[model samples]
Target: MGQFLQSFIFVLIVIILGCSKHATAAQFKGYEVKSSSTAEFNESVVRFIESQKEFLILFSKHSAFYRFPKKQSIDIQIRDFLEARSKTAVKVRVKYNPMTAEIQKIEDLKN
Candidate 1:
């Protein structure tokens, strides 16, 4: 009887863990892009964006990439990628600063 009860309790715990709410909720991620080291930051940002399936958020108001000489090329690439993804059923939000966290501009690709 003792062994059977232990087995049942272990199975119940497993079921609860497997059906966690976070498993279905959208995940949130953040990245910091600085003007002095945009190369690495750009690469990381691209990877992060690509891996996302449902949502994306960016926080970088003073990014140097905007001031770079090759800003046009880099900007177009990122913009094009986001535009393509935005055509799908994904949600995207970007913030230039943390002060306006509640005022996220949501981009619904389904539209």
Candidate 2:
């Protein structure tokens, strides 16, 4: 009886592990962005926005504004462009980061 119980427990553990792996596989399916500097981030953002099919997500850090004093105007232009582009069913999501002063990541989610 003890041996049977141990086998059942092992099978249960294996099943749980398999389910967890599948869940994580579905969550981490986004493309990994590699941009360190603000310039790199801006370039990536433009490219991503131009090529995005479904959604474009950009993170604007506080430092980006400080680095480029004229960034506010550029940001406005970007938003206007995105808003225009989004008329064709594309979604634009811009998030602000107050804690940090650096761009974080650019995510292009295409469904």
Candidate 3:
């Protein structure tokens, strides 16, 4: 009886931990880009935008990539482009995780 109880408790703990982990992962914030415009698309911005578009189309079709976590924040994207240009002389630092089809993060040191 004691052995059975221990096994049951172990199973319950595993179930609880699994559920909490899944719930936390599900709660991660995501952003969707609404529009891409020429006004914001300079040379560096253009490259970054193209890469992002390709990532979205070829990789993360369902998930939306955001410049920021906020509802309407494109500043982070723009800043990332500018920073990449300054350091690498080209738009870089854009990362795509093919497995997840998600842009893990975007950042710019320029601002």
Choose the strongest candidate by TM-score: 3
Please give, for residues 1-104, the per-residue lDDT of candidate 3 as tens digits. Answer: 99999999999999998786554433333333333221121122232233433322111222343233222344444333333344443322334344443444
The alpha-carbon deviation from the true structure for residue 39 of candidate 1, after best TM-score superposition, in angstroms, is 27
Which digits, one per residue and each the tens of the lDDT, describe model 1 over residues 18-73? 65533322232223333322222211122223322222433243322211112332
Which candidate would rank higher by TM-score, 1 or 3?
Answer: 3
Off by over 4 Å in 3: 30-111
Worst 10 residues of 3 by lDDT: 38-47
**lDDT, each prediction:** 0.35, 0.37, 0.38
lDDT of 2: 0.37
TM-score of each: 0.27, 0.29, 0.30
Clash pairs, model 3 backbone: none
Q: List ranges where model 2 is wrong by over 4 Å.
A: 29-111
Candidate 2 lDDT over residue span 1-111, tens digit each: 999999999999999987865444323222223334333332222222332223333323312331111234234444444443334443323322334333332222431
Best by lDDT: 3
